[model samples]
Target: MRDYFIRRLLLIIPTLLGATIAVFFITRIVPGGPLEARMRQAMAMASERSMKDAGGSLSEEQKEQLAAYYGFDKPFFPAYLIWLGAAPQEVEKQFIKFEEGQNEAKVTLKTLLPRAQWTATNAFKVSEATVDRKGALTGPDVVGWKTKAEPEKQRVTVFRTKFNGLLQGNLGVSTRYNDRVWAMIKERMPVSIFYGLITFILTYAVCIPLGVIKAIKHRTVLDNATSVVIFIGYAVPGFVLGSLLVVYLAARMGWFPTGGFVSDNFSQLSVSGKVWDLTHHAILPLICYMVGGFAFMTMLVKNNLMDNLAADYVRTAIAKGATFRGAVLGHALRNSLIPLATTLGQIVTVFVGGSILIERIFDIDGFGMLSFQAVTDRDYPLVMGVLVVSAFLTLLGNILSDFFVALADPRIRFR
Candidate 1:
């Protein structure tokens, strides 16, 4: 088992590397980029300034400089490498010299060499050139230059990659929120975990016992009635149930807060008061979150238990002087729980993913809402950060599920 677990853990490295490579290239190929978004914002601001006063737009040179500043001028693959912190940082310096003669000005562009070897190429069109007071060309001519560089062993920084910051527990800054991605996620994670814990606890606590009872009762009225109720809960979506609960329980009866995870002055309240306030605000959302899971879990437990009860082992146990109740409990119960045990890992992952529509409806600022906003705003850093975390959890969860399945069933062994 130890060797099996170690092998499974080791497999995660290649899986994560492949996932990151796919995500990085796919995100880069998307139409709009941060640089373009920044340019649009700049243009809008420029337009607003023009309306207020005699304003001007950014020049071509200014645009090029902005692109370079943001590292947009580099090829996507190279930029990706730099972002990953696997490539060396390069800085270029250029100087243009002009000499005035009788009719036209002589133009020469020179690029300073860096530690890395580079080839420089320049293109200029001298449509009409006039010499300035400093003997520099001042005309409508265009000049463009590009340099290609190969880093030396001493020049390249081997430790830099886009994930370097992530490795150090930093999620980088949000381009949209203007704050640290880690800070934003940290602020919202509690809301998700709180409701997730409550939902998980309530669902299992209620459903497991109910499922066992339903299985024991089999085709009786009690089983049918419970099935009907579970189906109703399953049929209703969490968002729909949330809205209904808000209308009937919150608006009509005024038994709970309509939405939100806590009161504005919750910190000022006594400990018990704070707890009451939290539970009051959470009731509707918690109910909504749990209802969907309850029906499915109950049905799963019922079916698994019922099948195990009818198995040959239970019949043999009953024939060997075991009471019906003892046969079900001692011979069938443990095996019945194996299926549910496999799902434990997935439940853990759901805590982090949260429910987007549910959070939005309740006005809860959680990971789900943050992810939604990040995607819509194209905040790549935050989006990637969330994705990486989610992917890691999902992969880890599957591995954990395997361990759980092995634990639950002694017959199933890991080599």
Candidate 2:
């Protein structure tokens, strides 16, 4: 079992690699990326400044500068490498003064590559170049200097690349929000986790015992009534239920807060007040989150327990003078839980897998909502960051599920 688990752990690398590679390449090939969006913004700004028809596009030089800034200047593989932190990326640029003479001042810039290797084929292709008043390179094409003419004393831009990305704990920045991807994730993670944990705990706490009761009271009015109620809940989606709850429970009845994770003045409230406010706000959303899962889990437990109780071992245990309750609890219940163990590891996704629609309806800022925004906005870095975290968790959850299955059914073994 240990060896089997180790092999499964090793397989995570390739699994994650394949998933990320496919997504990374797709994001690159997709149209309307960050570059195009930025260009449109620039064009809009230019149109506004000139107060003219929006027919003009950015110049070639402007496009080149934007491409380099966004790292689109490189081909697919190199850019992907830079994002993975396996290859260096442009981090900073600064122009340096080399020589100062009465008549002429000489400045030199370094490329990302070695100075000696790049000097000959450099964009400027000259030993020395003078800047014009307009901040453009006056000499032959210079590598780092602006293509536009600039003042002689203008500060020239020199660029430097560095090894900084996923491998270095940098998830990159959001193109749309202009914020660190990790920071944004951290800010919203707690809300999703809170919802997930509560839902998980409540689902198990209520469903399992309910299932056991239904199994023992099979075909009775109590069991049939519960089955009807749960099936009704299972038929309705969580988001739809949330909308209904918002309308009747919050808007008309005035019981719980309509939306948001907490009250506006929660910070100023006392500890007890804070707790009550949080609970009051959480009631509607939590109900919506748990409704679907509650029904499914209850049914799953009931069916599994019923099947196990009818098995030969459980029947024999009861026939051999063991009490009915003891036979059900000791023999049938443990075996019945084996199937549930397969999904136990899914608890990980709960950290970030709050229902997007449910969260949107509730006006909650959470990981799922953030992921939805990232994809819709085409924020590549943020999208990739979310994918990385979510993919890892999902892979890890599968392995944990397997481990749990093994634990629940000792009769089972791995080679």
Compared with the true structure, all predictions reach lDDT values of 0.72, 0.81
Which digits, one per residue and each the tens of the lDDT, describe model 1 over residues 97-185? 22333333333333333535444552322243343323334445323332222122111111111233544565657777778887887
True-structure RMSD for candidate 1: 10.4
lDDT of 1 at 195: 81
Model 2 Cα lDDT, one tens digit per residue, 145-209: 44322235443444445888888999999999999999999898899889999989998999999
How well does candidate 1 match the true structure in TM-score terms? 0.77
Worst 10 residues of 2 by lDDT: 96-105
Best candidate, TM-score: 2
Q: What is the C-alpha RMSD of each candidate to the true structure, in Å?
A: 10.4, 7.9
Query: Which regions of candidate 1 fall more than 4 Å away from where they truly are?
Result: 48-56, 64-71, 88-164
